[model samples]
Target: MYSTWPNLDTKTIHQQVLKWINERNNGLQSQN
Candidate 1:
């Protein structure tokens, strides 16, 4: 779970979430 702090903007938060998810998925894909 991610901690929501520092009152980040919606767009920034959305981008951050997307980037983290993509990185996680990419790692799995590369391992297979």
Candidate 2:
């Protein structure tokens, strides 16, 4: 995995994942 990923730090990756999840949740909430 490190070979494929190379340079991203864990904090950056975690923030991106959290942002993605929040966007998805907001979309779902808006749909309801």
Candidate 3:
């Protein structure tokens, strides 16, 4: 994937990882 403006992929990947972690945490919290 690519953005219209030039940018590093690390930032995008980091944001995605954060979102994934948040979703996982929510699911775990709901189960508890």
In every candidate, how many clashes are there? 0, 0, 0
Model 2, 1-32: lDDT tens digits are: 43455688777777888999999999999999
Better of 1 and 2 by TM-score: 2
Q: Pick by TM-score: which candidate is best?
A: 2
Off by over 4 Å in 3: 1-8
- Give all candidates' CA lDDT scores: 0.84, 0.83, 0.81
Displacement of residue 3 (Cα, Å) in model 3 is 17
Q: Write the per-residue lDDT of candidate 3 for residues 1-32, one digit (tens) a residue.
A: 44643565868877878999999999999999
The estimated TM-scores of all candidates read 0.69, 0.76, 0.72
Candidate 2 residues lying further than 4 Å off, grouped into runs, are 1-3
User: For model 1, which pairs clash?
Assistant: none
Tens-digit per-residue lDDT, 1-32, candidate 1: 33565577777888988999999999999999
Error of 2 at 21 (Å): 0.5
Candidate scoring better on TM-score of 1 and 3: 3
How many angstroms is residue 12 displaced in model 2 relative to the true structure, after the best TM-score fit?
Answer: 0.3
